[model samples]
Target: MGLDPQSRVLIVDDFELMRTMLKRALGAFGFTNFTEAADSNVADQLMVEATVTRRPFSLVFLDWNLPGSTGYDLLCKWRGNPRLAELAIIMVTSESDREKVQAALKAGANDYICKPISIDKLKEKLEAVGLGKVRSA
Candidate 1:
C-alpha cells in the first residue's frame, strides 16, 4: 500500500532473518521507518515506551510464534490497552489454518499475511486494511 515513507513501523519476530526479510519486503512498498523486536517482551517494552513518549508505531508486523508470548497474545494485550488499541497489527505466520485466521481477525488483527510473503500478498493485505496499493512496487 501507500505507506508514508516516514511511517513508524515495528517488526516483531524471534528470527532476525525473518524480520530482515519482512523489512525488505516493506522496503519495496516504500516504507523506510522500522523498529525490530525479537520477541513479545521487547515489543511490549517498545510499545509502552513509545506510547509514553507520544510516538506510537503506525503499524506492526507480528509473528505468530514468538519466544515469550504468541503474536495472538500480544494482539490481545494491545487490543485491550486503550493507549495501543488503535495500532495497526498484521499477523505474519506460516500457518494458514482457517481457525487461526478467524481467531486473529476476531482478536483485532488489522490483517494477516502468510509466510514466504510476496509483495503482491502484502499489498493485498494492506489494501484490505484501507491503506491502498503501492505506486511503483
Candidate 2:
C-alpha cells in the first residue's frame, strides 16, 4: 500500500542534524508525522511503545552505526519479533559496501540509502518501499 501523508515515521540516528535533514526532506515529500531517536535504545523504546499503543510507525529510517547498538542489530531484533515483522525499515547510513547492503537486506530491511542522501534518491527509495509521496487532490 502507498504511504499516506499522515503516516507516522521514526528516524533513528545519532546525529541531530541528520535527523533534522531527514525530517525536512520527508516533510517536503508530504509526510507530516515524525519522531526522532538519537540512539537504538530510544528507537526501540519508541517502536515498542507505538506498537503497544496500536499506532505503530509506518516507516523507520535507521542509521547503521549508532552510539550503543548498530541498526543491523535492531533490524534483526525487530525482524525476529512478530509484532514488528511487518514494519517497513530503510537503512540510512554511510556504509555503502556491497556486503553491508546485502546483509541489511538479508536481515529484513526493506531498502538501504547511503548517506549524503539526495532528495531524488530518497524519493526513489521511499517509492520502492511503497512510501511514495501522496499527491494532494
Best by TM-score: 2
lDDT of 1 at 115: 89
User: What does the lDDT come to for candidate 1?
Assistant: 0.87
Report the poorest 10 consecutive residues by lDDT, candidate 2: 128-137
Query: Which digits, one per residue and each the tens of the lDDT, describe model 1 over residues 1-137?
Result: 34455689999999999999888888887888999999999999999999999998888999999997899999999999987766789999999999999999999998898988888888887677657656557
Q: What lDDT would each prediction earn against the true structure?
A: 0.87, 0.89
Question: Per-residue lDDT tens digits of candidate 2, residues 1-137?
Answer: 56676889999999999999999888887887999999999999999999999998989999999988899999999999898866889998897999999999999999999999888888888888885554432
Runs off by more than 4 Å, candidate 1: 1-3
lDDT of 1 at 129: 64
lDDT of 2: 0.89
Residue 11, candidate 2: alpha-carbon lDDT: 96
Clash list (residue pairs), candidate 2: none
